[model samples]
Target: MGGRGRAYTIVALCLALLAAGVVAGVEWARRWEGSVTLLGNWTGGDEDRFRREVLEPFEREHRIRVVYQGSSAESQVLAADVEAGTPPDVVVMPGPGELAAYAGQGRLEPLDGLFDPDHYDPMWAPEVAGAVHWVPVKADLKSMVWHPGALPEAEVARIARDPGEWCLALESGATSGWPGTDWVEDVLLQQAGWETYQKWATGRLPWTDGAVRKAWTTWGALVGAGDRQRVQRALLANYADPWGGSDPACVKERLEHQASFVRSGAHWMAVRGRYAHAKAVIPGARRDATAWEVAGDLAAMLRDTPGARALIRHLADPGTAQLGFTANRAVPTATYDADPMTGRVDATLRARGTMRCWDASDAMPPAMRDAFHQAALRFLAAPDELPQRLAVLEEMRARHRDAAWLPTVCGNG
Candidate 1:
């Protein structure tokens, strides 16, 4: 009784322990199957909107859990992760420039057959070394002038003539001067046409050239850049702030030059904002041609795991309509009809996709891009310093020779 009973009891206990271990391992495996990591620059309200409108639905439908990390320094974080061999499964970068560099280095996974490439404008999912590596998940039109309410076309032109009438907000954390860069880039695009804009943006044209020089001068005159008090305030003010300022000057700033997303700002929302084609407002835009500038957040696979592939497919769907503006033509036009402003922007994006160009600095390498931002800040502070600034920018661009620039920044002419 003692030997037989004791042996049977020990076997039963060992079997129980083994069963418990197997069950625990199976549970862990199930949890791991539904989880993926994503890195992006979307933070605060942008992050919330993405989760609410896009991510939450995907998670529910597919039963996958997304671990997202949003930060302003996402590129640096991404680089460190790659170096440490712990990169996120997916990443949504702010532009194609950074993605191009990553794809060229074999750090990114190709996105072939994940989604229909025909759904997007060719530029949004430009080829990377003969294979598509990234696609834009969100897009914003950069060439627009916003007024509190719908202003008559004639009135918009008149308001644009006066620098005092425009609202200038230069503050953007570490990227304070980017507003000016956008202005100059738009001016260049319209005045020089897409041919020259492309050449200049990709570093093929010298920064000291006449077309480039004229763009800076045009922006300075349009914004009254040298006016001391105004410059001081503009430099200090944050661009993200709502326009309903208590200051009489701010209240009187009836016009704002910003991206299409500015429609959601309190000032625009209160007044039922309207937009004018930026060309109409610019002082000396060419008579014959039209173009638009655009920017986007692009998604790329880093790990090629099952979870990452599913996230990529969800992002690439034309039916995913949460983005404020999308370049995907397959997105139902009805997706934006409830908001007239969004409707107009959606149309403009498609009509101009063949002509729309990337924000020049956004297409440049980071070193050149940051230098461009700082140069813009300097130009805003002192219009007379333009010559020196352009020279410095050219020098910096030369230094980044190894930087893999996005092959094409604009749609086919």
Candidate 2:
């Protein structure tokens, strides 16, 4: 209880206080490091799988906390957030056109020097000026025809001639009629080829062009003007439900033309499905030609930060890109062993050069894209109104001609 004892006690107290401050500072830094916001259109099982497989691993490795916002109306949500001056650090949108619009408006951060450029196809990460704006995280192969199993050439031909033997769905709630767009786009790609398809998609070619007109008529002959009862069912049915349900009565003998996601879905498993490229089934399809329609979920940084950049880097890694069931072969990530259908799709997507093409509607300006969908529905309801539909689409294209349209949606190599 002398002067020396009091001095020693004061020194120990000072040391303890310093240690506590240090600990608090470290804790605060840790909390700050572990936070990022991501916006995407993956909900339900897709969202859950992503969180478990991709985000959780990234979080564990880097100690970053991801704030994920998954919505069916992701574009609307993102627009609201951007307008409010509070966009997420990163966003994974399906449409490159929408992402391009955001990039043009300076809402996106340049993803320069974050990941290897060679890992992705040029079409997946189109450059703005000299900077890449986004990277594909997931891709779906469109222009595929799904059947219960492999059928003979004769059976295939017979089914192609009968509209009643086809499964068609148009209703998608707010996005109603996009399924029909896929049909016409695939038909165009198969009937005319990528050159003409790309030109029309980007507004370089008018909708009234002979090739475009033929594409529409070809689709009309196939489905749009086909059977009345089947068309009615297609008009009322939800697009996803056809691929997700096991209604034999509705789907029997009916081959479905849908994206590759159908093979990875639970309903496809229940039905024991199989698929062939659309070109193989389309009547009078060019014997020497091959083309594929594709769609992808692209990741772009909106608010650049260390955490956001890290997340982007992870997504850009070819190894990480395969976390989801992507049809992209450029990303050599994990493969689904049990799902052979996805394996076939992955191989088809990986095929080189102009054989692969992005979904034309997805690559078009938003207004034109929506118009395309509505036009599809209209054309289906009244096949005789093809001229009118073509005229209307031409008007929409003219209105948005000056807007940003991708110069290319396919790679030469």
Candidate 3:
């Protein structure tokens, strides 16, 4: 071979080797010290707590750098990122309903090999295997009743029988009318039981069904007229803030059915514990009352880098449960017995209990969720317009056939 040819070959080999070394070095650095970006709906104080108690610990233990970005309305931000093709590595949201869109679009990776969900609590009813799209990092039991110690079961019973004693916060900023929806879900459980609850939530049962019509009618009568004027007056008379101020007088006047986190608010006087109180007030408290509720959080994966994997692993670890609670995120699927961190009673409200997982709204698809929220808000504003409101909801559901067609993990076959 000629000298010049030999020299050219050596140079080519050297360049190729250098390029391979650079790629290997970058991958190694990512494994040991690269940064993981995370996004969440928790901003300000909530965000700081998560970093201090959750993210910081993970970084220290794994020796990986973390870039945590938080916002009060992260859903909008997430949509924008997904559109721009620059999403974060990991995301933590309130429920799976929202994440289903991303997963169905092939943006989210299946979490089967990521964690052993069985090791977690069993309150998640659809079961972790069926809910393979997302893993719940935290949860707050809903379907609870709140009232001051001054108010007794008898008082609540009277209020439940009389519409006048009903009080609702029709004014929750941006997410207005959520309180009303809470009432609807609780009432559904009381009137029809879990089987009915699943059917209605998954869109299997029409809104005009006898059971549904009764629920809507009952809610309408609370603020409507005819012979229920006295009841409506009583409900309005006690209408005040459910939270804040020296006392949650509204909760005291009647019964406040809300999520377990209400205990942290200033107005919360007392509860039987997280799950018990919710069960006690619902119909069939003796038969089906439970110390748990269907609950779970949506963990969004923004960027698919190595750093993100570390964050997911750390947060999914059972050891991190306490840290999440301190951050105001209830541990998802927590057994109702005794939470060592918060010292709250954690036990099934019923001797033979069933813990149904998944929030009704979060399980619905995008169009249906928006329609449900809007329809509820309109109905609350004008109780007399219930027929029109129901029509709108039905029409919206019809328009979004895709959402209505989603598979149900647990529902009527």
Candidate 4:
């Protein structure tokens, strides 16, 4: 009697344990079925807005979970992940330049097959579709000027005539030279027009051209007769407090040229607002050609898993546009969307016409971008050595032989 009873009890206990294990495994599998991993640069408030406006809705509707990993050094993290064979399903890089590197390494999934190419603005779709590297998520106008406080019409004319008030931030860290590059592009647009801007941007035009040289001279003069030493000090000092509001360094660069994203906080500090404040800056000041210009923060897919495809779908929709614009995110756009507070300001902005996709530095290759950043620092410090600086840029461009050219959105004509 003792042997039979003990044997039956052991068998029953074993069966119960197996059943429990199977149930636990099933629940775990269910939890991860629609879940996916996303890795990229957004962090803090930006991450929160994305989760609130975009990811939460997406999860609710599709029954998917997004494991978002945010970081400041996203590119480095992405590179390391790829090397370690543990990559994310989707990534929203700052620009197409980095996307090109991933695409070349065969780390990205071609998106043309997954989404409708036409749904995106054609300007953004250019060379990105069939090539299948990246698609634009949202854009901001880069070729814009910001001024703090208020300006009288007479003052606007005065500033335009006197380049001394035209201030620029030379402390953009890994992308420091970009502010300089924006200056060069704006100068070119004012002098040579869009066609020439493209030539210089695409490297079809020589870096040593007279216009290019002139750009250096103009920018160098703006920085005053300082060598890289002085400018570097300023940049380092400026960045020491780059968290926003107002620093004498940034404020002194009075007319900071940057994307629209910084408008609210920066402008709130009364450092600057849009340059086209018709009533404030120039009562009767008319636009040169187009009323507006644009640039974008683009998202690209890293791996081609089904999870990645779902993210692509989420980002491409018009509804997702609000994610980048939420109060928490604070990334601005040049597109005319009416705000009850801003009223007809956006409408007025659109009426003037638009200049399209002219972010010069972002359009260049990654290595060249690094070179461009350092060179701008050098150029600011050594205005007289313009030729030498440009030559260096030319060499850098040559080294990145495969730097892909993205199409211009507004200035093709």
Candidate 5:
């Protein structure tokens, strides 16, 4: 009885201790106020990078569990969640206009105390109704023309004049035609300058105004509006298609008008190419034009719990913004500035006192924004129908005219 009973008692004691430890750990995790859900549009490499560089560190430092959901149809998914009354605690989207709409509806919590206003300018964190609703986490320089190598200014000008030499892809699935919106935005900025561009973007100017009409016609002329084959190819092509390929025809194409994110494409040409400011090659660009079009991924809070607010504060740090390349001047740039190609693009974006405007299509209300994209596609398909298309856009503009527009888009500094 002594030896056998002693061995069994020791084994039972050890098993009881282990079970007690497991119970304690589970209870601690359940009671901790350190769990938040995040919804975003990032996927693939970008999502991996954000998890590694941004979310993981925050989770470790604050002992928070971040449940992330990445989707290409982020807007639709967000809408569904909001309608179902189960929206995530935080969301990072590429469109501020949509955020503004949400904020106006009181769906977003104010970041006024959570984020340092000094870290971001008005354009990056515009306020509405006395509350800062969103902040930029990533930015890209748009309205850029990427070419394999340096081309003379004269050659660039001539290429812009010839429709056959231009390369474009309008396919982005559900967001198909947004690339076209970028072109028109760039042309408006170049030809009409920033002030006029802002007016058109913010609904102050009519879509049929002469300057706006000129921008549309100018884009049409450059992309070969009446040619079915060219338009068809553009319609079928993905935005990243021009970045790389073994096809001689694609390789020989001299110019690609796209955003800075095109640098991430797998295509050999984009990897090896450099970009110039779009104004350099834009026909009818103002001689003194210094405007640049830009876009960014923005972060906003939906549920302002202490853990969620802490996450926003972490993201607001300049160091956090610098973890990725951004157009924000407040973020450090030594890494990007070292490369000549990116440096040039970076310089243009960070230029002191120069006009830097956010992408207009991304700034308008959803209805008008969708109309702008569809209008670009329709106009490209039939240039003759432009007047009718402009009229349709005017109606959309009137419908959404009451929507809030950012007070100022171009920063003085």
Candidate 6:
């Protein structure tokens, strides 16, 4: 070979060796001292709590970094990232249906043995299409009516029956009208039992079905829907604010049909918020309305990187169940006893044989869930339009009959 040709070959081999060495170094760092990116819909104090209670410990223990991205528009952001081929390493979001859809598209990595099954109920972290997909990290309980000040169950019961006697707040930004949906869901679960509620949630039960429509009518009557001035005020009021959007001076005398998370509010504390099972006073409630409507923040892996797997294991650790409520019965009871209200919520979450159905909209396909939220707002504005609203929802459901829905939405069955 000529001298110039030999020199060119040597240069090419040197470049190849340099590239290979660089790739090896990067891979080694990633396998040992890597970072995982996470996305979730927790912002402000919620994000802070998650960081303090979960991320910090995982980082310290695993010596891995967690790059968390918290946003109220978590669904939209995750969808865009997935389409752009830049999805996070892990995603922590409420509503398993969303995760199930990704799992169906083959966008998610099968999380088969990353966490111990003994820490959670099979339903809390169920398999999708024969492969384990997600694990629940936190929980929220519905089927509760909060009242200010201590009152006998009978007194709370009597007040629950009158729409005029309740404090209602319906607005939530971009997801306004969800509070009404919660009311309808708890009412249905209290009236129809888990079997019917589960069917309705998974789109097997038509929205116009007897029980479904009856639940709508029940909520309409309970909340005085279509009282325009009152309805408008509620439609503009924010659900998370203190006083259920009523005057603070009079909040102590009102009742709010909300979830367990709101127990920490100042108004609730000032008046000593107390809860009663919605079944106790809901109109036409079945004698045994044992199913509780609940929400959960479920963790799923989108990238099969080693860092992501380590993060998932840390999340499933029993000690990480320090979130206000845990589905993991193995978590110590003291973890929840920080306050009486929280302790009670945690106890209900851990109660054996107590069924927990997913929050209806939270368990639905994103499109269907968004439509349901709008339907609730419209129903509040025009209670007379329920028949038309039910027809619309049923039509939408029929179109998406084969959508990826969670195999089992309720636990402890």
The models' CA-based lDDT, in order, is 0.84, 0.80, 0.58, 0.61, 0.81, 0.83
Candidates ranked, most accurate by TM-score first: 5, 6, 1, 2, 4, 3
Off by over 4 Å in 3: 1-32, 120-131, 162-167, 222-242, 245-254, 269-293, 321-345, 349-353, 404-406, 409-413
lDDT preference between candidates 1 and 2, better one: 1
In angstroms, how far off is 381's CA in candidate 6? 0.7
For residues 179-298, write the lDDT of model 5, one tens digit per residue: 999999999999999999888887899998999999999999887887998888787777756434554225457778888877656553444767777878877899875788888889
* TM-score for all models, in order of appearance: 0.88, 0.87, 0.74, 0.77, 0.89, 0.88
**Residue 367 in candidate 6 has what lDDT?**
78
Index of the highest-TM-score prediction = 5
| Model 6 per-residue lDDT tens digits across residues 1-413 | 99999999999999999999999987865563778999998999988998998898887778798999998888889999998999999999887878888888888898878877766666677778678888888888899988766678789888776777777777777777788899888888889888989888888889999999999998988878988867776777778873643353124337888888888887888778788889987888888547788888999999999999999888887877366678877788888787787887887777877788889898888778888999999998898989999999999998888888776778773
Tell how far residue 2 is off in model 5, in angstroms. Answer: 19
**Candidate 1 lDDT, tens digit per residue, 1-413?**
79999999999999999999999987864564388899988899889988888888887778788999998788789989999999999999877877877887888999999988887777778887678998888889988988867677789888787889888887887666888899989999888888899988887888899999999999998888889998888887788773646653356777888998788877888878888878888767876877889998889998998889999999988877556777777778888788776777888777643578888887887778888888888898899999999999888877877677777788842
Candidate 4 root-mean-square deviation in Å: 7.4
Tell me the deviation in Å of residue 237 in model 3. Answer: 15
Local error of candidate 1 at 354, Å? 4.8
TM match of model 4 to true structure:
0.77
Candidate 2, poorest ten consecutive residues by summed lDDT: 325-334
Our tally of clashes for model 2 stands at 1
Better of 2 and 4 by lDDT: 2
Q: Tens digit of lDDT per residue, candidate 2, span 252-352?
A: 64578898777656656676777777887676577687888989989999999999999998887656626455634545533655466665667666655
| C-alpha lDDT (0 to 100) for residue 127 of candidate 5 | 80
> What are the per-model C-alpha RMSD values against the true structure?
6.5, 5.8, 11.2, 7.4, 3.5, 9.6
